[model samples]
Target chain A: MDLSRISVVVRMRSARQAIDLGFVMACAWWKPLFLSWLIPSALLYFLLTVLFHHQSWVAIWGVWWFKPLLDRAPIYIAGQALFDVKTSPLQCVKALPQLYKSDCLPWLTWRRLSPSRSYDLPVTVLEKLKGKARQSRLRQLHRENANAAICLTMVCIHLEWLLTLGAVGLALLMIPEEINVASQAWFVPQEGPMLWVQSLLSYFAMAFVAPFYTMAGFALYLSRRIDLEGWDIEIRFRHLAAKQARKPAAGLAAACLICFFAGPSFFDPPVWAAEISAQNKGPKSGSASSRAPEYERVKKQILEILAGDDFHKPVMTQGWRLKKRDAENPNGAALPEWFIRFVEFLEQNNAGPNRIAAWFGRGARVLEFLMWSGLAFLTLYLLLRYREGLEAFARNAAAKKQQGHPPNRLFAPDVRPESLPEDVPTQVRRLWQRGAARPALSLLYRATLSKLMHIGDFVFHEGHTEGECLAIVKQSGEAALCDYTMRLTLLWQALAYGHHAPQSEAVEALLTQWEALFQHGQ
Target chain B: MSRIPLDTQYQVETPEGIDLEAALAGPVVRILAYAIDLILRSIVLTVLMIVLFFAGKTGMGLFLVLSFLLEWFYPVLFEVYAGGQTPGKKAMQIAVVNDDLTPICWSPALVRNLLRAADFFPFFYLGGLICMALGSKFQRLGDLAAGSLVIYREPPKAALSLPNRPPRSPQLSLSLEDQVAVIAFTQRHGQLSRARQQELAEILSDVLPCGSDQAVGHLQGIGIWLLGDRGETTSL
Candidate 1:
């Protein structure tokens, strides 16, 4: 009821601006507003789902139908919060009956689909207006901002759908491509997990949008009232009156008399308030009847002074100015005064126009020459300053010409130098002795591939299969190295895919050949 | 009460000691303005399609190029040259401005508009919408990235044109806020109904002491005085 205590600043805002204000209000009190909205709505969503698990469509319809009722919770919290009322979410829940008591039936049934439902809810819920009075009140409120209210509803509806779909789309993206669930299952799930997920997403979207919609509509309602009632003016006036009420009556007559005669300079409000409060206190100064005529005379004098030239000084001087000259002056001011004057001087010397133009062109040419020469000098300095690095870079590039960068992984296993042990044969032999037969052969195979790629400078791509690796080695025509790779590739393929363990003697033979062919350099 | 006014106004102080304030536009109004821009862009494309139908392949090629440019640069061009307001923004009475509250220049405008693609992620502006709703200043991804803002362009205040009553000072000296209230009352005279005005004026009965019959007129007279309006009899 106290307009000064209203949380939002009262001003004449456009309908859209009003909605934005509502959003700010919602943001400021999101904890309470969203909690009050979410708790009840979420409970109802769960209850409906459990009761009508078979008929999920019913659950969806029920949740959707009860939205008008559910929306009331946030609206109540926001309305209370607007007046600086400290209501917890639990308190808001307990107070829901009071919020829904007035004209609730109409909201659920006939007026459920009202485009401006939130905007009109305040009239019923807060003001407790009902019947013909409510109708008339709505008629009055809807005159200006009805379209904005409708637009708010439309936008919020779209926002809810967008958020829901965005969530679903994000979920779809996160699911690996190999398990590509058809999008149809997401949008139209009749029963089971998908249906439940879809319903939950829909409810979540609705809940998320509820706070913004409710608060925005409430703001529209508040803004409309502000426009109609001048709530801002009332607040300021109330503030003035409050200040006036607090002043003591210490200096009464002296303050008033000085304020009256000395004009605005001596019109200090606190002193005058002390005087007025003293006048209102009793006949300590004078009786009311005796002061009336004197007050009238003072008021008349003040009005007369206000009507003097000091308050209203209207001067009118009509003349013609050179329009073209004024236009030229404005444009001329864009350039520096000296620069304009220099250009004018150049233009005025028309006889030597060609000579002056040549001199200007020559100066421009000299400056361009200086800039280019300086740039060239800088480039040369840079070249000399970093000559060693440049030469090293050239040598590196030439040394590695036409070499495909060593693939980090040969097919699946990492072939990087960092991945390999210093003595590959020793590690493979230890694994074999431990009876980790398949690992021993695979490790030997991987070591061979790594050596081929890094030491032998052989290129392999991620797509290359075991046969392709053997073909690449065969193409290289290194007899001993290619033969060793062929045997390792066969053993790796047999053990890895066929689940067949290789013979220990064959693995030992390969390990010894691998050491001879590869480890010797190391 | 919150010490600061809990409205959506963004304020910054300059080196010159001037406080520059702009009302930060939230997603609702910005969305509406964007919708308007989308419709306008569609209309232009449709019109171009018809006009270029007769020019064959060359015209079709030209149309494609024009559409690309328009799609990306329309907001940028208007923001840079048209006082930071696109046609849709002008209609909405909002404009783009730099974070420092200056008129948006070309570089920022281009950066913000081009990054609209990022804002339109996963689906149509859901990311942007969420960002705006959550952001303290209601800045979308593009706005955050470019350090630009969408703000309500405050309309010029209408001249106070109350009836030419002889000016009257209040019974008590009025404070600055009181003066503003009176001025606002006078400015909104035409917009508010007569009964509403009287009702508002009645609230000031403690100070004015004007009876119910003359309360509205008395407040207006005081408002006129506050606005520096001399009496009707005072000739220029």
Candidate 2:
């Protein structure tokens, strides 16, 4: 293609790339933010349980899910860094002129290259051409650019998905076994097919899964982009003739798979697996005895936490407190029956009055309470942030309009009244022949505004009503005598369709007066 | 981007293509434009008032901008954003280009919105109208001092397909004198280089007969191939 057409293509492509890059980065950036909204809370929940109360290792290990901060950060950074690195290639992809300057081509030779054929057409024929030619060229350029941008964006999005999966896995380990197996998390069901869904989720809270997913997604996006760019073809050709490359390929693939899937298996051994193995080796009676005391204490404590009150203690109280119950009545520790039913209705399978009774369960039931309360906090935070995000977005977008238009004395002087030929008095013709006065006024407003603004004049700021604007002009004395000129514009805009002028005709009359004023100014 | 044909300091060029002088003269046609704008706007507003009476707040609310912003800065925004002319400016073959003869942008749009008062004097565009009528090139106050100019955007047309036929042989029948004349004429066509002009002229001259300037004129007078109607055009 010729230089101008090449330039158009390059520019169109670059802009498309910029937009795509922007979108990819935005999505990648948001992933961690969304993850941050959840995982941190889970970790905090598990950590708080460890700190505030002494829990046995078995009970504690059950809730271990999301990985450590160190693992999460590197994975998160990789997406953004990868996003940055991927987009970096686009920056190198610049204007065609710059492309010629790149290392691939010898600069001076390309810069000074000339078109092979000479194009000489008569001015008369060239003048017959229209602006649509330029516009079409621009549009074509944009389309090609948009395609390239789409490819890059898809790569980034795929990487984002992979990373999210890692986070989900890590979240499984951290799932606070209570939130998972016991349906502690709000609005979740604990049984039937829903139970299987619960297990898949529990996998994320299971600790090391996050880093694994993170690495996997990154690898996947890389592989995908490479494939799309046809880099795999180059790779295969490089390998086809070599000695077996399986060892290197297998090593790289294994390392990626292990980091993504097996990295966390090394941390925090499972206590339940040991118990299960031990139970298989011995009698059931022996296994039950071995689990006796410790299980009972945990069950007691977990029940209390679920009930939201201490059932073991009885305190003497005053009149308003009602009778100082003789025993530490466990029944009294529960909420009112109606309130229980209300809470049960909020849960799956709890459509009736007896639903709250379903809360009675083993040690991990505290997860249910934590999950329910967390739901409230999550919803409120999200709503507030969404509103704030909107306001912030607007404020950020409007930061550039303080400068003014160019000054008048910059253009070449002209002697002719109408820039166009007399035969092309478009507005004059429109006034006489175009539809009604509405179109005419619109034409007039446009023609007048264009004519006035072209004389090195400034348009208005958002402020300054016509009256206020006029006063400022009069006070400035720059064009004080300009009043009493064209009144048509204001009359047309303010009271055009009215039965009477209502002070508007006077405005229209002033426009004609402007013709007179100019004569006076000269 | 930005507008085109940026002005340079201390340099005078004979800009035959889209010159500033030519562009500034456009608004001369807009004086009558504003007069029409007045008539149309009045009629529309009158209808609007009746609509408002029947539809009440509902009608006004639906076309809220028409109720307020339309009169306020809608025209200014549209003009600035739409390349200086409203629908009116467009049909009139006028556009509001920057002082340097580039496209309109935000600041210019805002400035026009602000300085709209100066353009409007004594209730009408009396001030601006007069500026266009009496000032040089019929430019209004804004266009005069702002280095801006009202220009026309070229209409769309098909690309030029120049007539080109490779020469059969280098040894054309035409004489050197006719070749020189054709070369000189074609030299002024900017798209072709001097060498290309010479080459084309040589090819065109192939159809001419051996001759002096007078002889070539006589041959053309008799109707040679290159001598079509262009032969009668002596200004070349």
Candidate 3:
């Protein structure tokens, strides 16, 4: 009767609503239902395929469709068990055959064979409606529930397909190389008889996932009913009303009737009640109004009891205390006689100081030798392991030092490899002809940097300088491109820092050579 | 019979006389989180298998042991020690907490993870999914037995302030609940789109002296007044 704990949003739910509920419910019961039904069905399918010596779609389809029959009993039991606190998965399995015979067999008509009938199962199985009444009930339910039933079936089918694929993939992974080679001929398209093994594998996989589809639909049906009819709220109210009806008969009136028939003496007031009545009737009734004196008396008695000698006695008689231990005492308060004797024996056996130091020095020398050798060995191992990587890092660092300026000083961040137009030589020539010497040289420098990064396979760390770029190009061993790049760099340095703009003829010469170098590099 | 409203927010009263509210994660979000974990597990396994390919028989033995430990204990180890979240749950911004909204302990974490065998029944966690959907707090069977709840880590944002216009008293007196609702609507002005804000305000036009078009400004004025910003009263 804890009304506060009850959920308040109950109503007749649609089929879609039922499916949503069913999906989660299936998640909860997935393990037991899967093991007992789906696994066994799959095992049966495997046995059938092996015994018949044929791999047929008929076997796979039989296993898949046969799941509905196997699942009927479990679904019915699980749906009922949802409301019962004590019904376990084992109990449901134990009661399976009875549930199936009572609920599923009666509904095997040709009309009920459609997949959509899975969602209408609870009404048929739980409510026992049939014929026109069942059809009208289903239609009404469908109108309210909407597309949940169809969606549930579709999702389950898709999940089954995915599971089947996964199973096949796993089997392929585990299959022996010899078997795979032998089966290669059968794997070709349209080889029906030869593909029997593949069909058996698929059937086995389908069996593993088939029960979930049936159970999920059942769960959906239950959820839709809960939503539509407020089953939760009804259960709560019924529980409360039943308890209310049972209360008076179980306790108060029955007890009082038994007491009355027992005896008059038994009905007499108790001694404490009589004493209280006598006190109220006395002139000391005014004293009853103030119980301060009684409280004070009790307080005094408690104080007297606390003040007794027994209360002042110490509980702990023995405890360790710190004390100086001289030769006469031999042992401190905290130290036992055996520990003291052990310390004395160790002192007597101690070696002389000089001998101990000499021994220590010899041990230290050996330890130092071992430590140094280990360090040397570790260094050698690392050098051998990463020789190429270390060499590249050293070359980049050396190039950076030789450049004496950051690479960004020559090229701005905005310059990207693709930023250069197709007619780079024409663009540079136009800038130089207009007496934009520095700007024209900058364009050639940017292009060279982009080309070296993209085609030369050079690693450019951040902060690489112009000298570093030149050093990298020279080390790359492209003699002609290196010679062209060197000439361009000297001209750019003269125009940019020395403020000595190059002549039009010199700029023209460099641009023509740059285009030739670029073409050759491509 | 009336339907029972679903309650996603759980309130826990601490010994310190404080209430902590946890917003429970639903089945959809949990499924997404689980999928993320699955992908991560596969990636780890693939990497290990590739690396160990050169190690011969010993490597194969080690690989099997590592896979077994990872499959069984990875979530348990992370959940107990790594602030109640696995990497996937962390990515999804959800966490496991005790039924009382406290940080989870080892026993509960272990129990929940071990029962995953039960949850994973019938292939791809069908049992766990159904249980989570039906349970009041989106609890799987493992969560129920372990006394744990998976909840959104982030708290709901506070309401926005009303526009800075002069306060004016309402033309009509309102019940406490109605007044609170109006104030809440004004508080959420910034979050809602202009059209949405206007539409919401117009719904309360019956209580205002103004027409539906002017209801937005009228509500803001009332909201400011409710905030104790009483000034010269103006008619709409």
Candidate 4:
């Protein structure tokens, strides 16, 4: 494990940032990560679903319980890809034995429900640690990182459920309202098909969240190690060492000498070192160091290679652009001689340009006539199409002048002030006492609508239903009136449509509230 | 293997020749930030609805218009004015910037925020999440459309606390990397465990040939020397 080859920019990061970095890695290698995770998990789900067909919950639970084992594939892929190792889904599937070879039993058993399973899996899988070593290793890693890792697990868990519900919501959106499937029926499916749909949704949701969960844990592990072991510093040092090892001794000494006298921090370390070495070497002989003979040979060979044909290869590229015209004769004649003679003949003719102009004017006049006629015809056609609606609009406009006095009737019953029996609540109570709950609730509802329209200035159109009347009264900005209207409307709906009778006491209570709300019956 | 580079840092050279680097915010943090915004939006809308409940039809009309503005222009106003951070983004310590690493402008901010509808299509940002996961810079559909990026705000530098030691030049010629490591080692004396410091000190035994017990002190001396701290006491 060469620290220099680790792909990510390693630095001390907050736990959330570490998890985010993990998400980035999972996305970058989504193909292999998804492949390795989805294939086996989906297969297990399918098998369990078939076996436990009657109990779909069992299948989902089985799939979920075995997630720790399935998580290994993504963790393996992410770990390998961090070092730029190419891996396929098939390779990940094949490496399952090696991946699951260490500390697998505990993860499947007691550790299965661990909140930080994603963060802890790499410890058992990648490090291959078991027993006491794994415990201490986890302790060290979790010292400062436990909260974030647990938070990541919690967040991903919520995200999984959210995505599942979102997916179900999207499917529900596709079902047209005309289908007449009740909302309760769509959500609370008691049958096998809906159960299967739910299982599949949840399974895919888990599959979606798995890669991010595993990779985030992996990043947390990597970041923790980087902090404890100084991986970033180690990588830089290794690169420096490799550079030094590659350069020959004499050339390095010369480079150091140049930097020593350069008075800048460009080649930082060597300059200071050269100053010390120069002082130690007594200054005079510092400029003269033994040179390797192979230097000139390598330099000449490098120059010869650079001056080779490969370096000067020609690249042909073709495209179109406007042709550059000659500046001295920018508009020089470039027309055909025949076209020029034709133009001269036309100019010489007496009725040449003016005749053409007159012809254009005639054509323009004809087009103008056609356009005006077209507009006039369209207007006539629109008037004819909507003639009945236009007549109704005019009739309604005339009727609005007479509507200063509110409409006497709204519902099927005439709610005229003169038509009502003087004390409406008393009449309703008398009807309720007679056990005629239907007419009693209906009379109360209609009387309220009539009062709202006439006295309270609430506007109820002729076609407004009981529900619409209630809505109008509620929107009238009077709380007590809205409350009374709501109860009366509900009771009216139950009796009218649903054929459910309201209790006598409930009707009496509504009549009392109605009396308090609308004092003057007439 | 994907051709995209696998790193979180997005670096861009500005017209002024300054290299601006930003840590690209990934899905987890971004999702969390968005979740915070979602909660905040829900709360504000809920409060608005309650307040406007008594105003009847006119109140309902005003509520709709206010919610529309809050829904669409909430992020835009914050990003353009509040240093590119919405309230949620500020809490998460992330900000929006142009692809060129400039402060967010009005048009780009509007474009990115408006395209959130597309990103939010079909479900709970599933399309956006997929795009962000696949994009090299973790850019979602809105970001890609608007040429913007969500990046982690640069954290303030930690106060330097090097140990008080006499400066002594390293006996052997050290490379630039070695100097850095030694300086970091000195700076992180209290953070790194004493035993771990001794272990790291042993890696360069040829350069700092002091006993294991005194290696930390010797390295501190060399770190001070590398930092150009002569015998004088410097405020770090």
Task: Tell me each candidate's RMSD, in Å, in order.
Answer: 27.5, 48.0, 28.9, 28.1
TM-score of each: 0.63, 0.21, 0.35, 0.63
Tens digit per residue, CA lDDT, model 4, B60-128: 999999999999999999999998999999988999999998899999999999999889877778779
> Which pairs clash (backbone N, Cα, C closer than 3 Å) in model 4?
none
TM-score of chain B of 3: 0.79
Name the docking class for model 2.
incorrect
Q: How high is the lDDT of residue A116 in model 2? A: 9
Write the residue-wise lDDT of candidate 3 on B1-236 in tens digits: 11334334578889999999866776645766677898999999999998997898888999999999999899988988988899889987789989998888999999999999888765567678657765767899899999999987864555566687666554333445455655655665654456766765654554455798987888788777667666642221
Instruction: State chain A's TM-score for model 2.
Output: 0.16
Inter-residue clash pairs, candidate 1: none
List-wise, what DockQ does each model earn?
Answer: 0.27, 0.01, 0.05, 0.18
Task: Give the Å error, residue B188, model 4.
Answer: 3.0
Residues B94-176, candidate 2: write the lDDT tens digits. 56766665677776666655666787653345456445433434456766555555554535444333233221111122234
How well is each residue in A298-380 modelled by candidate 4, as lDDT tens digits? 55665686689978998998999777555546655676678878778767876578786887799999999999999999999
Q: lDDT values of the candidates? A: 0.83, 0.40, 0.64, 0.80
Off by over 4 Å in 4: A86-95, A175-178, A246-259, A262-522, B1-5, B170-179, B193-199, B206-219, B232-236
What's the ranking of the predictions by lDDT, best on top? 1, 4, 3, 2
Ranking by DockQ: 1, 4, 3, 2
Highest TM-score against the true fold, candidate: 1
Q: Evaluated with lDDT, which candidate comes out highest?
A: 1
A353-390 in candidate 2: lDDT tens per residue? 45334544532488788998999999988878798787
True contacts kept of each: 0.63, 0.00, 0.10, 0.35
lDDT tens digits, residue span A25-119, model 1: 88888888788878777777788878987877667678788878888877877777788888865787678887766677888899999999889
